[model samples]
Target: MSISSAAPPKPTQVLPYATKDLHEVYTLGTKLGQGQFATTYLCTHNTTGETYACKSIPKNKLLFKEDYDCVWREIRIMQHLSELPKIVKFHDAYEDSFFVHLVMELCEGGELFDRIVQKGYYSEQEAVKLVKNIVEAVQDCHSLGVMHRDLKPENLVFDTVEDDADLKIVDFGLSVFYKPGEIFSDVVGSPYYVAPEVLNKHYGPEADLWSVGVISYIILSGVPPFWADTEKGIFAQISHGILDFQSEPWPVISDSAKDLIRKMLDRNPGKRFTAHQVLSHPWIVDDNIAPNKPLGV
Candidate 1:
């Protein structure tokens, strides 16, 4: 998890892709997930009879070869972590004529977003549990210098069951590594979750915290904190820092929880709390300390 200042900012070579390692004749089952750049399939290991989520990133859609390079970074980041129970496991990467195939842990649990909408809103206790686990996972990512630019609930998957379940952080397409003093300038991420600085083309890991705030709001209420009539309206609201709590729809959430959200959504990155700090907040630590409860506050 130590940051290496001397290492190159980004790796060049496409992390070696081996097709033979992935047994052939493996049938591609139903779709698992899809994004702008990749399509995921549920596939079984031909020999071991094990299941995996295989993500195919088409080279053509990789606007620049750098996108392919990012895939390598994602591989390296995933490989270095060994096995973080909360983070999705990356098994292997290979290439076909049309795309690069990434074999990853198959999580059958549907998106957290669907669950949120289905239930209208999560109970305070349930929210605490999910948030705590997510914060712990983010802390792990920060320790490794990997920042997940997009961290919406859709990217968080539950393996099955609600209590003591493994919530895997999936999708690293927009992930990046930053060494000390390294400043990243990329205006990327979903509109609702993106930080204000991101819209202005200036951001760092704190931006991810902003996304976490948006998610917390969604978990407490059934909708995002910032909604707009149009994309421009949404961007303006985010840019102007116009996040207001809806008094009526707001659940019986703790005051500490609301304060934590405010701290995370702070417009100034300097004022925002780091993942580690957020994890230690009273709302997360004192009020809710179940063995593996979600950090609700």
Candidate 2:
């Protein structure tokens, strides 16, 4: 959709958050966050006063045709997932001469990674609740032919700080629609959480589940199962690294939890459990475990 330029608002000179590339429908608030290609700001509706987050990306920075199309793809993907549960809600978007503005639901609880760091850890029971929500989101995405190329704790956010808050998966910049068995060649994702097949540049939706495995390991241990001092070492570890479960915290972790990770992190992508399969895993489906135990150390 194109922006309507029907009537220019008078007193345009003093327009706050108004640019040729953005609309005055949103009144800019405090700065929320910034990233490589865009900066997010808290915004409010001019008439409704409802809060939202506006991602402002400079159009000039899109030097290549692919870069421009990538943004549009993100918009389309978000539109497709507009009503999906456990996902950040997308409102609408606008483009002016300078930037593309994508308005999304404002999440107040911040990143799941921050919670993991601050709380020291979560029990398998607690982690199960979180992972189940995430896997369901992923399963939904896959069902719709969407592949979240980048899946990590950093992209997971909570709707609020409440214990029962919904854990929503956000960000779709690297996401794409792919059919089952289709392959992708471009390498994309955070180094630590990427699947081994992603490094090989030939992978499908199962690659995302591998990242889920990495996230599962992190949620239970407060540390990634694989790590290295350098990027090369990290990649080496991902390709042939031994998942460390013999250390301190592993003894206390339930075997079911470890087994879940093992199946997802398997080197062979073909053998990795899909998101739907993960939901039925013993670790995720068992809600009868004893009270939540802290495994943060």
Model 1: runs farther than 4 Å from truth?
1-18, 21-25, 118-121, 288-297
What lDDT, from 0 to 1, does candidate 1 have? 0.77
lDDT of 1 by residue, 59-159 (tens): 67766566767888877777766388888898888776566778888877667876665555346667776787888888888888888999998899987
| Clashing pairs in model 2, backbone N/Cα/C closer than 3 A | 21-96
Could you give candidate 2's per-residue lDDT for residues 128-215 as a string of tens digits?
Answer: 8888888998998998999999999879998888778898988899999997778999999998999889999999999889998899
**lDDT agreement with native, every candidate:** 0.77, 0.84
Going through the candidates in the order shown, the clash numbers are 9, 1
Where is the poorest 10-residue window by lDDT in model 2? 7-16
RMSD of each: 6.8, 7.3
Question: For model 2, what is the C-alpha lDDT against the true structure?
Answer: 0.84
Off by over 4 Å in 2: 1-21, 289-291
